[model samples]
Target: MPSADPSTQPLKSAEELAQSRRRFPGESPQYRAARNALLKEEIELRRHIERVAAQRRALPPGGEIPEDYRFESESGPATLSQMFGEHDTLVTYNWMFGPKRQRSCPMCTSFLSALDGEMADILQRVAFAVIARSPVERLTAFKRERGWRHLRLYSSGGNTFNRDYADEDPDSGDNAGFNVFVRSNGIVRHFWGDEMGPETADPGQDPRGAPDAMPLWTVLDMTPGGRGTDWYPKLEYGAQSKTGT
Candidate 1:
């Protein structure tokens, strides 16, 4: 056979690359075959995720923030730059808990709940924070209720940070946004953000960002019964009483 140029050679199909032979006991041959087919699709999904991530990283520097917006932290007032701490990159989640609202958005709360657990691990690489439009006291109270200890919570009240960042609805004040900022050579600039909204949602699906950020949905997707349309996370679930009490 004539030697083929590596660059010109056609890439192997995902199905062709799936070579798993191990089988679980009691699994039918039909089941194994179906699983192998699904595995091939999963491999392609992983590759697509990597490709999109690379494109994100290669993006040109985003718009420079003109002002050092002020925010209320547990310690006191802090600037956007101050939020970065020792890291050049900062990830801030704009939670939908405006002062006027009695409760925060359940969806935002759900996302934050998962993030709370990973705060320590995520902070090791970059600065992370959860910002809300409510007053610091109110935000802290809810934080306590949620049992989130690691997430650095902040209040964007008394500032235009939320409005400037598109994290707050100008008229309604309800918001849920995830934004990233980067400081390079003493200049701060917007890095990325989750711009997807209800308008962008596909037919019969809720609007969600690519590479879903929450594990709840991801785990549910793996099961035979996928994330149900009617089910959603709640702030409080019904308590289970002690047996025989």
Candidate 2:
């Protein structure tokens, strides 16, 4: 292969890159060859993710929010605009924990559990909040139960925010949704949302976004089992004593 800078030479197609002959220890020649081929595809997948993200960022202004939706936060009532403190961008994740449901969706809970750890880092760039249709007290209790300290939790119990934002399914009650909004010159406008659901899911695959928001699934994907279809996160795992049995 040429040693010149990659930019100086013609771009290598994914197919050409798959021809890498690198080898690893304790691996059969067949496995090494297959692994090298897979690496090229992974590289292309990364580039595609960046390309789609750029397209999303370049989207024209989305529909302006119809009203200043109200919500109940830890510090009393607040409006949509108030949620965006010092940033022009806001990301709201709608949790599927409705008043009528016994518990929140396991999938949503799993995703939020991971997000809670990253809330501080995520907030440095943009405002982030978690909204649920349950009463503030109920939501707060769950937050405490989960030991989520960084996620800013809010209640949409008395507002139409959930209904208007596709977070509440009229026929099925609560649903999980991720919405992004932008505030410019005192105007709040919808930016983007994860609209992919059962309708958009591919054959034999779950309905999920291109770049999954949950790290659990991503990590599991690299394993030999490849995210087994029968397994999913649970609210609580079997108890284990501190000391080894």
Candidate 3:
């Protein structure tokens, strides 16, 4: 049996598809027209996201890591290769819970809170871990407090893993980072890391990358206010945190 060529197939009209789905009662013609127009853009946005993902998948092999970074896990010491478990690919989030910080970055915590829910599903495919400069005990204690059972927390306090990959500046301190690595033929290599920062930021906009990673921001962006400038995630919504962890 021969399969149809997707590229050669005729495409459906976004406008028609958007309008055909559903219509609300008492919607005015002006509202419907505007809604339909926005829907078409949304369709294009989805297509663009696919294209970007495809491009990322097609990237050539990145530079090999200089050394096998060490980490302290709840179970004890682990190497970068050991972190991959049975999978060749590993996705790590560098948490901003350093020895100097009073508490973990609220923004990082929010992202992890959402990611924790999907950790099981994520691990079913690629290995996922949360790395922090804080001691393993400190990291695990916070994990227990947050009730995050699925996340694999490891301490990078004994190594330069954070300095190399997590944007750990000697003076400015640490910033949350997301990085991917791959192990091939018994060698580990850097795959990619989030590079968007203040230098790349657009005017009047916060420094963030496309297809925003945080669900909190994504959901807010869909609202009428569209992720207001003044607000941000907090460790405790209404309460003040102590000076140190």
TM-score for each of the candidates: 0.90, 0.89, 0.92
143-177 in candidate 1: lDDT tens per residue?
88879889898888878878878656656867677
Q: Top TM-score: which candidate number?
A: 3
State residue 137's C-alpha deviation in candidate 3, in Å. Answer: 0.9
lDDT of 3 by residue, 1-245 (tens): 89999967887877767774567999988888889899998998987898898898888999999999889998999999999999999999989888888888888888999999999899999999899888899999999988897999999888888889977873577777789999999999999898998889999998887889989889888999998887667787534544322
Better of 1 and 3 by lDDT: 3
The backbone clash count of each candidate, in order, is 0, 0, 0
Candidate order by decreasing TM-score: 3, 1, 2
Lowest-sum lDDT 10-residue window in model 1:
236-245
Model 1 / residue 102 / CA error / Å: 0.6
lDDT tens digits by residue: candidate 2, 1-245: 85888535666788777776666678898897788779888989987998799899999999999999989998899889999999999999999888888877778888988998998899999999899888889988988988988888889888888888865664578878899999999999999998998899999998888898889989998999998887677787667323221
Tell me model 2's lDDT, rounded to 2 decimals. 0.86
The 0-to-1 C-alpha lDDT of every candidate, in the order given, reads: 0.86, 0.86, 0.87
Which pairs clash in model 2?
A: none
Candidate 2: regions farther than 4 A off: 1-12, 15-22, 240-245
